[model samples]
Target: MRLILPILFLTILSIKAFSREVASDSLANIARNAMFTDAYIQIEGKLHSKKLKVEVNLGDTPEQTKAGKEYSEKLTGKSHMLLS
Candidate 1:
């Protein structure tokens, strides 16, 4: 029904907004705990380097999961990563 679709959409949007709020807060925590002081990334098949879709997660150094995200984002033109 029409009403069902609108209700579903609203619920999904609210859930997304809430999730983002939570994730950002976690980002602050991660940054504080991150192990890597700083990082740079490389892109595949690109002659010139560019920085995009960039965000640094918190840790003293970059952990595997966080670094993997940065690496995948850099390669978005050629590939993307997803968590399950």
Candidate 2:
């Protein structure tokens, strides 16, 4: 029914917002933990590179695609060393 759709939408939105907040808090904690410093940095770097990869693959925005290609080129030789 119409009421059912609205109720489901609201419930899903609330759960998504709550999870986003929790994930943000967890990321902050991970960044602050000295023991996790290296791991955190590595994970962050990989995430950035992966996002750039998606942009390069899509080639939707000219500016983003160009920047991503340049950035990825710079990482070509270094990624192997760092990721290892």
In terms of lDDT, the best-performing candidate is: 1
Candidate 2 lDDT score relative to the true structure: 0.52
Candidate 2 TM-score versus the reference: 0.26
**Stretches of candidate 2 exceeding 4 Å from the true structure:** 1-59, 79-84
Can you write out model 2's per-residue Cα lDDT over 11-82, one digit (the tens) per residue?
Answer: 999898888335787788888884421111112346435432211232446765566676556555343344
Clashes of each: 12, 0
Error of 2 at 68 (Å): 0.6
Error of 2 at 6 (Å): 50
lDDT by residue (1-84, candidate 1, tens digit) is: 989999999999989888833578788999899854444443344344343344334334447557767666655654333222
**TM-score against native, each model:** 0.25, 0.26
- Give each model's whole-structure lDDT: 0.57, 0.52
